[model samples]
Target chain A: MRVVREIALHVFKESVRDRVPYTLVFFAVLLMATSYLLGQLTAGQEVKIIKDLGLAATSLIGLFIAIFIGIGLVSKEVERRSIYNLLSKPVSRRQVVLGKYLGLVLTLLVNISVMVAALYGVLAYFWFVSDPSVKAGWETPALDPALMVASGLIFVELALITALALVFSTFSSPLLSAALTFGLFIVGHFNADLKRFDQIVASRPVAYLARALYYLLPNLTLFDVKAEVVHGYHVPATAVVSAVGYAAAYIAVLVATSVFIFERRDFK
Target chain B: MPAIRTEALTKDYSTGFWRPRPSRALENLTLEIAPGEIFGFLGPNGAGKTTTLKLLMQLIFPTSGRAEILGRPVGDVGVKRRLGYLPENPYFYDNLTAEELLVYYARVFGHHGSEAARRAGELLDLVGIGGERALQLRKFSKGMLQRIGLAQALLNDPDVVFLDEPMSGLDPLGRRDVRELILRLRERGCTVFFSSHILSDAESLCSRVAILSAGRLIATGTVSELLAFGVGGWELVMTNLAAATVARLGLRIARATEIAEGHYALELPIDAAPDGLLRELTAAGAALVSLNPIRPTLEDVFIKKVGGARERATFHHGAHRDHREKT
Candidate 1:
């Protein structure tokens, strides 16, 4: 347990020193600023547009953090030969994998939180300063209740992506792992549509293949509650609970697979 | 008890596509290094020295046979805690300072607070990196990096230390320092198993040596035991030796050469010693300038063993082929 914490702390400090995290944060902030501007162009739907764009920015940036950083965690260790030092210690291979996973997850969590805070500040600015009568029709004023729920769902989504990256990193090179993880993230986001297409496809064999892929790929769209929050659609507590549960199961399976592969790999 | 014991250990790596050949990295190697012994594992490139070390360290699993450390299986975590390894061409995180790197390892090894700090300080000084503790490892030279690697390997004060080519990139002075460190570790009753291609280094430090060639243990024993494998002979430089003196001794002169001031080179038989012969030569009117015995070195023994095996195998195959053709 102490080994896990030590690895986590080392990774976290190293990530902070790296410019990648700060660059992503800056991009997220810029995204929020652009969304605010877009809200003005949409006129009466200013708050709704702001919430949609802000949530999208958060999820996108969070996905980038998870895939980019997580894929490099183990692959970089192997490339640098630092795995030898860590493995030569009393620490097990599983501990190293888990520690890296948790560390990257913490980084993504902090990044998502900061982006959400920035979005909240933007929403709050428009809600208070603008005249309610003039911008009310242009904006359905941002609701704190829906935004909080949306953030919770996004966290689950990011956690799942982080796990997916770790799973790919265990067997593949960093570049291939990153590319495949990013590709998976894109497919996961549209998994619902892929399932729908599977049903509509004319060929039976092709439909079976599509259906298989849909089941294998995580349905990331299920965790997107930004649309509900944007239109003032009530997000039931049960929906958030189910999404959290799904993410947990998906991450567990991926992390277990990673541990299995890591244990067998020869670090020569 | 042996610090490390391997019984018929073997490792094979597959190479070539479509028709793969299993290249044996270690083949039927059996060795037992006792506790507190500085054992030198020597071989040329691709001779299975590193493969053997890896098997002992449990970095990779062997294809067959068994290896044990401290009476435990190679992969046992309890055994690992008491073992420290410095690999060939070790690399560390470039971003971490010397102190940070050692502290990190100390923490992983379960040391903490002032104890960790004090140990880290002592190790940094021991590795001669006292002033450079705060500087990131990226700025360190190859020698400094090697020293830092040594520091980390000693972080746990392990009972056994496995160093692979530890002196590869070190300067002469750095090499001397490492030699001293290994000696010090031996004084502390730590078992040291290190591999080096430099025969002199192995000859100087190792109490016992194992020579590997073509993925096989060509020879294993003390230096003198290996040297004794090759034929021993004595060389005598004397002058004005009577034919009677030579005939009475029955000494076969392999080569008789005249030196600068009327000195003759007399190569005696393998088992004959010049101790008794020298006194006889001095008693005669002959001036015995020099009498030196020519003994085979470890290098010679290694070459002979490897070369002899290849020649014998080739000879057997050739004879078998001729017999088949005749049949």
Candidate 2:
């Protein structure tokens, strides 16, 4: 466990020095700020626009960080031949996979936290500047704690994407890993549509194949509470628990598969 | 238990994309390295020297056979605690300074806080990188990187140090420093196993060496035993005698060449008694300069063991045994 933590801390330090995460977070903050200005032009629906754009920017930036940096977490070491130094140590292959996974998760947490803070700052500015006497259609304050539920689910989504990147990275090149991970992320979000196709299509084989894929690939849409939170609707506690549990299970399977592949690989 | 042992260890790699062909990297290598000695693994390019090192380090698994280090299997993680390895042209994390990198490696060995700091400092000085501790690795030269690599390998003060071409990217002075460091390890009773194509370096340091040719163990023995096989003969220097007179003597002289104004160099077989030659020279009123035995060098033995390029191209299994039997 100590060895795993040491590797995790080392990887964290390495990622902290990398500029990719910082650049993505900076752009997300900029987008959040831009949404504030864009909100005024929408009039009356300014709060909803700001909330929707803020959540969108946060999720999009987090996805980029998870896919870009996570894909290179192991592949970069192999390319640089630095894995020789690492694997020659007393740590097991499982520890390396776990450590890198934990490390990238930590980086995503910090990055997402910064973007969330910036988003709240934009919402706070709106709350302070808006005139209550104008009598807008909705009277609820834009700064709601309920939005955290949306952000938390977004984090879960990013974590799942990060695990997907690691699994591909264990056996493939970084470019292929990134492409495959992004493709899976896209397919994961639209899994419901694949199931809908199964019902609409008359061909039994195609429907069965589509239905099988829908069950096989992760259903990431369950984790998205952005629409509910943005419209000031309550997300059930049971939904949050199930989504978090799903993310955990999928991440475990991905990481376990990664460790299995990594263990049998010969660093020639 | 032997400090290191291999039982018919072998490795094969598949090449080509469309039509994959299995290329043998190491073939049925069975060898043992005893404790507390400097052992050199010598071979030319593509002789599986590095492959052997990698297999022993568990960076790669063998296609067949098995190996053990410190009485544990090669892939045993606990065994690595007593092992140190420096790869050929090693790469390290460039974002880290020397101190930070060493501390990180030290932490992997379960060292913490001030103990890790102290161990890092000690290794920095040990590898002659104390002054460069604050400098990031990206700015370091190849020689400096090699030194820093050596430092990281020694972070745990391992019992058995495996160095693959430790002197590879270094200047002569840097090579000497590493050679001395290796010697120091031996002085402290650490088993040092290293692989190198630098025969001269191996000749100077190794107590025993195993020479590999085309992935097969050609020879393994003490330095003196291997060199003793091809001792050329005895050499004699004489002067001041007519060529006709020397020819008239009928001694089995191999060849004679004039050295300076009157001195001549003479060669004879190992069995030739020098007393008869001395008596004959004195009788002919010639002066004697020096007589010394000519022994083969490790380079000569290595070339003979590896054979010429033509012979190497046709190298096959059981060839090492044929050469051994003939010798």
Candidate 3:
């Protein structure tokens, strides 16, 4: 446990010194700013528009963080040949993977929080100072509850992506791992649509194949609450609970897979 | 008790996308290195020296058989804590300074607070990198990097140290420093296992050595043991006069070269040269100026055992030939 914590702290320090985290933070901030600007074009639906764009930007940037950074964790160690030093210690293989995953997740959390705060600031500023006619669309003057739900949803989404990236990183090269993780992210978001398309297909065998793929991929769009935040629709409490559970289960599966592959890998 | 022991260990690398035949990296080989012994693993490039180290370190899994350290199975985390390994070309985090890198390693080994810091400091100084602790490793010279690598390997104060080509990139002075460090480690009761192609370095540093050729342990023992076994003949340089009379003494004249004045170089069969040949030359009215017998070196033993292109050259020149071959 001490080894895990020590490695986790080391990973955090390493990421902080690297420019990649700061670059991602800057991009996330820019994303939130662009959403606020885009909200202005919505005219009467300014709060709803800002909320929608903010949530989407948060999720998108979070995915980028998980994929780009998480894929390099093990590969970076291997490339630097630092894994020899690390493994030569008393540390276990599982500890290395878990510690690295926690570090990347912590970085993602900090980055996501910053972007969420910026979005909240922009929405609050627009809500208070703007004309009553522009603010009339909002059911409340304060921050929307749906946007909070969306933030929670994005956090879970990013956790899932981090696990997927880590799983690919265990056995594959950094480039291929990143590509596969990103590809899975895209497939996950469109999983529901693909299921619907499968329903329209006539052949039962083809439908079974598509259904299998749908079940295998994460239901990322289910975690998306942007539409609820934008149109002032209430996000059911049960949906949030189930989404959180699903994210946890997915992360557990991927982490296990990563451990399985890493255990057999020959670092030399 | 042996610090490291291997039992018929084998490793094979499979290549090709389909119908791949496994290339054996290490054949069924067994050896034991005692505690506090400086054991040199000498081999030509591609002779499986690195593969053997990798297997012993548990960086790679053995295809068959087993290796153990301190009586524990290889790859056991408990055993790993007592082992320090320096690879052929060590690469470190370019962004981290020497102090930070050591601190990081120390932390991973579960050391923290002042204890970790103090150990890191002591090691950096021990490896002669104390003055450059604050400098990033990226800016370090090759020799400096190697020193830092040595420091990192010693971080856990390991009982068993594995150094692969530790002197490859070092200058003569740097090589001397590393050789001295190995001796110091042995003095401190640490078992040092190092691999190198430099015969002189191995001859000077190792108490015993194992020579590998094509993944097989061709010859293994002390330097003297190998020389005694493989060295076929010796050269006896004589002088005075009467070459025909000296030739009639039944010692096959491997070579007879005339030096200035009455000095002559007589390269005779080693077995015949030691049989009262010096007294015989003097009694035959040939004044023996000097009688020098040339012994075989480690390189000769290595070349003789591992017969390749170089070994063929050495064979033509005979075992006692002293033509210098670059390692």
Candidate 4:
């Protein structure tokens, strides 16, 4: 466990020092400022506009970070031949895989937290000067507590995406890992539609394969309650719970596969 | 018990993506090093020296056979606590400073905070990098990185230290410092198993050495045992003499080399007596400075063994292939 912590801390330190994450977060914050300015252009719709744009920025930045940084975690170490020294220590490959996954997840969490804070800052400023507490289209207040629920699910989704990226990273090149991971992210979002493919497609074999893939593929739509949360509508607690549970299961499978591959990988 | 032991250990790498072929990287390597011995693993490039080291370090799994360190199986976590390894051409994290990198590795070995910091500082000074502890690794030179790599390997006060090409990427002074450090470790009863092409260092330091060629062990013995043949001949140095004087004495100087004006270095034949030469030098107004025997070196032994192996392997493996062909 200590070995895992050390590796994790090392990864976190490496990620913090890299310029990519900072650059992405800077852009996310820039988008937040853009959201604020765009909100000012509308009448009585500033709060929703800000929330919508803010969440989008968070999701997009989180996705990019999850793919780019996450894909390089193991592959970069291998390419640099640094993993040789680390593996020579008193640690197992399983521990290394877990540590890498957790560390990147920590980095993603911190970046998402920063983006969410920037969004709230925009909302707070609007509340301070305009004092527009209109509840016309909103089911909740201007400063909705349910917004955290949406962000938390975004984090869970990012965590799962990070695990996917890590799994690809353990065996493939960073470029290939990035391409596969981003492709999986795109597929994960649309797998929910695959569950109902039997109604749209007449071919029995295609429908069966789609149904099997629906169960196999990650149902990322379960995590995106952005619409309800943005509109300040009531998001059920059950939805968040199920999504969290699903993420845990998916991440476990991906991480176990990563460990299995890494254990057998030659550093030569 | 031996601090390190391997029993017919072997490794075959699967090459070719679509149709895998078993290419032997290390073949039936068997070895044992007693505790506190400075054992040198000597081999030419691609003679499976690094492969053997990696197998013992458990960085790569063996295809067959077994190995043990400190009576525990290879890859055992508890055994690794007592073991340290420095890879060939070691690469550390570029963002980390010497202090942070050492502290981080210390934490990997279970030390934390001030203890880790203390170990890092001690190692920095030990490796002569204390002043540069705070500097980032990216700015460091190759030799500096090698020093840091040595520091991290010693962080645990390990019972057995494995160093692959420990003298690589360093100046003579750096190599001397590392040699002294290895001596220090041996003084503290740490078994040092290092692989190096620099046989001169091995000849000076190692208690015993194993020579590998073509993925196989060709020789293993103490320095003296392998160099059992007596000194070849005598080399005599003298001054204030011309080459014509030596030609007159019927003193058959096997080889005569000039040192300076009116000075000469002379090599005597193996069976030739030095007594008459000394007398003749003094009578001929020449001063005899020194007489020394030329002993055979490890390089002589290495070339002989590798050369012999290549001749034998030519029939089976092929004549075109060098014995130390890259894996």
Q: Native contacts retained per candidate?
A: 0.62, 0.75, 0.66, 0.75
Which ten-residue region of model 3 chain B has the weakest summed lDDT?
B318-327
Candidate 3: how close is chain B to the reference, as a TM-score? 0.80
DockQ of each candidate's interface versus the true one?
0.62, 0.77, 0.55, 0.75
Candidate 4's DockQ: 0.75
- Pick out the ten consecutive residues of candidate 2 chain A with the lowest summed lDDT: A132-141
Error of 1 at B90 (Å): 0.7
lDDT values, one for every candidate? 0.83, 0.87, 0.81, 0.88
Q: Provide the TM-score, chain A, model 2.
A: 0.93
For model 4, how does the per-residue alpha-carbon lDDT over B154-269 read when each residue is reduced to its tens digit?
A: 99999999999999999999999999999999899999999999999999999999999989999999998888677787898999897788666565778888879878888888
Give the residue spans of candidate 2 off by over 4 A: A28-36, A39-44, A134-140, B235-292, B308-327
Minimal lDDT window, size 10, model 2 chain B: B308-317
lDDT, candidate 3, B1-327, per-residue tens: 689999999999987778898988889989999999899998899999999998887779999999989999988888888889888787787778999899888877768788888889999988888668999888998888888889889899889999989997788988998999999999999999999999999998898999998788888898778767643555555566675775575536676677754567777775664557677777776765555557688898787777763465468677445444531
Runs in model 3 deviating more than 4 A are: A28-47, A127-142, B230-293, B308-327
Query: What tens-digit string does per-residue lDDT give for candidate 2 at B1-327?
Result: 788999999999999999999999999999888888899999888999999999998889999999999899997999999899999898988888989998998999889899999999999898888677898888899999999889888888788999999998899999999999999999988999999989999999999999998888989999999988755878888888667766765658777776775577888877788788888887888877778888888889899888863286566436877898899
Better of 2 and 3 by TM-score: 2
When just chain B is superposed on the true chain B, each candidate scores a TM-score of: 0.82, 0.86, 0.80, 0.91
- When sorted by TM-score, best at the front, the candidate numbers are 4, 2, 1, 3
Candidate 4, superposed: residue stretches over 4 Å from native: A20-28, A131-139, B239-245, B248-252, B261-263, B275-288, B318-327
Specify the CAPRI tier of model 3.
Answer: medium
User: Which of the numbered candidates is closest to the native, going by highest lDDT?
Assistant: 4
Query: Can you write out model 1's per-residue Cα lDDT over B3-94, one digit (the tens) per residue?
Result: 99999999998889999998888899999999999999988788898888878877678999999999998878778899999988889988
Scoring only the A-chain of each prediction against the true A-chain gives TM-scores of 0.90, 0.93, 0.90, 0.94
